[model samples]
Target: MAVKKPTLFAAPLANNGSKWSIGTETNVMKGLSQFHDPLINWSVESYSIDSLGESIALVVRNPSEDMAVTPRVDIYLVSADNSVKPKLLTGSFNAISDSPVFIKDGKKSVAREWDCSPESIVWSANGQTIFAVATDQGNNIIFAINATTGNCTRMTDAGSAMGLGTLGENQLLFQYTEQNKCVDIHILDIETKEMRRLTDVNSDKLRNVYIGQAEYFWFKGALGDQVHGWIIKPLQFNTEKKYPLALVVHGGPQASIQNIFTSTMWNSNIFANTGFVTVQINFHGSTGYGKNFTDSIKHQWGRYPYEDLMIELDHVLDNCSYVDKARMGWSRWVRVTAALVCHAGIFSTPGAWYGTNELWLPEHDFGGTPYDPKARSNHEEFNPERFANEFATPTLFIHGGSDYRVGVEQSLAPFTLLRRKNIPTKFVYFPDEDHHISSDVDQIKWLTEVLLWISEHTNTTLPYNLNQ
Candidate 1:
């Protein structure tokens, strides 16, 4: 007998396949609203189907009833035979906090978070057990969630597991990335709970090159909250030599720095190779720790998270003998802290700054909703414009004109003000791009501008034509 493929049911705007045969503007807008993740990869909220075609599971994100700016993801199951309507599977209280399906270089990055989720749901050969990725207390792991009951069982202990899929009858195949290491494939046996490494791609290429060393540390943060973080030492670092510290802050006020392969945009390997000891602080309001930790910076925003960063910085500079306190510099992409750094004068020796799609407008800050009265007040404090009179750091602002999430004006306004104040500032705008620079050409341009600016300010010379 031939197997029937599962039919998909989603609002017209769902990133992938939708149940609807047609589309409309209103449906698109409704679907767009469900993209709750800061790095919104337009994809289906969730997809799952039983082997016997008895049920289809869907994870949909809808506007939260309590919070106007937040969207909550919930799972629902419907009878495949069409004999029954959809019934909610998971409760509203527990959110499937996996980072969405991450596709990098045409290969799936096996990590899941809200909205953009798992590449595919893993089902046992008998379809009795369903496995999915979830973020539990600041760690990403695979969990055995009941297919029908919507219950969950933790499966893997490896802090991070990506691209999880079924192997053989009782095993799983996934791409694994550990702290300060390269990405590799691994296999897990469900019955005996045994895990075996599959491949080591890093060893072949890195035989002669030194890779950074990484370790985890915790500290007391905002409101005496326990904050977890990671510190990555420069390649071939010496204990007696002090190196410039690079403070890299992650976006998502809701996301945390994971102990996965450090390749992506904030390339830790490149930074380590460039002779900089990198530090990533989960700070306040970072995910994978706990709901309270992630939510700690909800309204606190700039103040608490910055404090957490400062405390971490202080600890590193004090305890770590290799961290050069006089040469400390910081960098962040997308949303968190660019404005805060400018307005608050946080970093002692701020270096060449690279920020894209900066959020500086009161109307657009903090979800752009009237739900929170403090959003405007918070924006007013950290607003890049507020620091124009005293903007001292040499800054490079880049933005995409088509960015709907954060308007180009956010970068343009500050760049103009800084230029007027006679501060060293540069603005690079791409009219065709959105919030993210998707095209390779645009990305290279952005990186080139960043490297040239940093090199100019740091008094280093890179063998690139700066005229480009």
Candidate 2:
């Protein structure tokens, strides 16, 4: 059987005195363009040419067989003259090269996921070093890699570096954000490794606002690995009094909740300001730790992550004496909402094939399709529907009717099951919205409902009137 691979074509243009003419075209790299392995898939994410045009840097992505595993990313130096094959400059590391901008809606702000892309690379003036950004632990770190030796050195401290740009010859400019602070422009001196803020755009807007204090902590996970998480203390927090806990589960089972101010939908400060302690665990499958840690969730979804969450919760309860263990509730993003479903095992429903738009997601995470004989056991084992009989917690189901990623049926099915089981559950559906509630009105409604749900279950008072 012959395997068809994506071909990279290049067209050179030559200006013949008066007009431009298409010269003889050719394949960019011929047979060496993509990974030849039949089992693995690969692609060229981005490419850069040196100032002299003698060398080109290419970011290649070779995804793993398991979807949970971070794709192997490498920087290859290819000579323009085609005298030699592409040389591997850097070894495989989880690269988060794309820097997404922060989104603001009224007073609420959101930082989208640190997408992996080519924008993450900044070539030094001489083209001798490549400064790239990657997620480490929970911070978006910048690393200066030697173009020749591939020796990498960490550049920035603890914060999320959103995007990078060249600043003169010695410094790199980037937008950075921390858990307590909003996004600000900062400059990094690659030589001395000194970073200073260049702009404080939100200082005035936040001068009178109260933000929660975030503290990072780690505990032994299900696999005995050090799982990381964050705990945000409520506004006007006091050690003498106990506060309700809101266990917020991040989406992307593959993504990690970093030390950055996120969107209004999942903002930890919202809960903190509402007099609730907010906790977010990175769990086993979450990225930024390492490839092994990210790959640990393969085929074992719902198992390891659930175990890690429970274990981390226990750790928090044991250490944070001011947390009211009895008054605890949890909320999750769309995909991992299954984590909550796993808690009480929802009703048996069709697997990922029925509602999920991305087929590769289940194919990669579940080991195979739902109908595959070998994968059936895994699909059944991790399916939240399999555990429907165990559900006891009061739940609120929110879904966008137009959501193509995971159909609204995913929520409706569970909501129906919970209703049948006499468990308190509410379904909040937005017909016009997509995966995320984006509009200003919807955002307000979403947060209001979420806070109301948690307050009702935990017996906490709303910090402010939602009707206003």
Candidate 3:
């Protein structure tokens, strides 16, 4: 079968004088023009022409090729004069050349994922170098390419570039994050590639409150590969006193939790401010590290990654003596497949609150990939229904009725099973919401219920707002 694809083509400009055409003429065009070879498997994402208009740069994504969850993005360079064919830029991989320049700020303050994209190719004043944003080791940074020598030099590393623009002859203006701080303006010298901060937007306001301190933790996984995670110490934490621990599991099973200011259904800062030590583990399948790490959990959903999380938990508990082992609680965004598996194994844990349960419905959880009988059987093995009789830990299941991604029925099934088996379970479904409860009213109610459930089960109470 011939695969149809969108191909880029260019045409020459033509001018007609007043005497050249006296009547209206309609010409029939039938033939097609092709720029690159038809055998290429990639599609153009975005394109830009250099300042001199000598070469054109194409941000292309290889649909046939993928790394972990997303496709492999590369830049293809072609001559605007049609002198040279399109060639993939050397040393480019896992890049988001077509990503939009958005300010990744939180509601309360600016965010840390301050990434910026220059107009594909921002030719230097001398037109000798091209500056752009590229992803490196999960973080996006500014990069400069020597157009003539083909040498690539990194420009900025303080934080991801949120916005980019040329300043003067040798300086570039951009908004970026610094360390664990919020977004701010900075100047980058093109010649020296040195960056200097120009603004501190929220420093004074943030100084009044205690912000959670995040520290990176690394340990060897089951396969001897290094695993990474972060432990956020509660505000005004004291090393002498034991603190309650809350473990957060991210969804997508394939997605990752990077070192950015993130505030979603599972907010680390909220947990920290509420007097609980928080931990986020990027298991074997999380993105950003590399293709190998993301693909490690392909078919082994609840196996390897679960072990990694357990190992990570053990390491944190052993290293952080201030974490009260008896007061540990579990929480996660959306589907809680990994948490469900581990929660079943850990009977001594106080309680677990999973925002969504995707275990019973494997088709929805795995994006309808259970075609063969064996695959369906494997799904049954990971199904929480199998252990309904043995489920003892009190678990709360909250879901959105309109969540078509992972239907509310997924949670309903397990919730029913647990209740029938007298496993102490609660189900809170929101009919007006979708995969996520967006409205502030629903969000407050959801968080309040979650905190109340945890407190009631763990013998610890959070400062709940009665007005909410």
Report the number of the highest-TM-score candidate. Answer: 2
By summed lDDT, which 10 consecutive residues of candidate 1 come out lowest? 343-352
Residue-level lDDT of model 2, residues 1-468, one tens digit each, is 545655354455679899999765554544354356665555667776655545566666544423233344666666655657877656544443322211122122112232432226666777677777788878888877776666777788788887788889998999898888898899888779899998888889989788977888989999788988889999888999999888888777688888888766777888888998889889998888877888888888878998987787789889999998778876542222222312112233235466666566666777877788998887788677776677667788888888776777778777888799998888888888887778888888888877887787778878687766
lDDT of 1 by residue, 1-468 (tens): 433322254223334564535343221112233343444333346555554545555565543332222344666565544456556655654444323221212323232333223324566666666677766544577887555566666777756788888888989998877665677888989888788888987797878776666677888877898888777787667999877666777765567777676544465555566666778878777776655666566546667887888788778878898876655554632122222122112121011011222322222335443234554455345444444466566677777777665555566666677688887878788889876677878876776676566545554334436575
Measured by lDDT, the strongest candidate is: 2
Reference-based lDDT, each prediction: 0.59, 0.71, 0.60
Comparing 1 and 2 on lDDT, the stronger one? 2
Over 4 Å off, model 3 = 1-138, 143-159, 164-169, 178-180, 191-193, 332-368, 463-468
Model 3, span 78-110: residue lDDT tens: 665455655666344544556322121211212
lDDT of 2 at 6: 57
Off by over 4 Å in 2: 1-119, 332-350
Cα deviation at 97, candidate 2, in Å, is: 10
Q: Sorted by lDDT, highest first, which candidate order results?
A: 2, 3, 1
Ranking by TM-score, best first?
A: 2, 1, 3
TM per prediction: 0.69, 0.76, 0.65
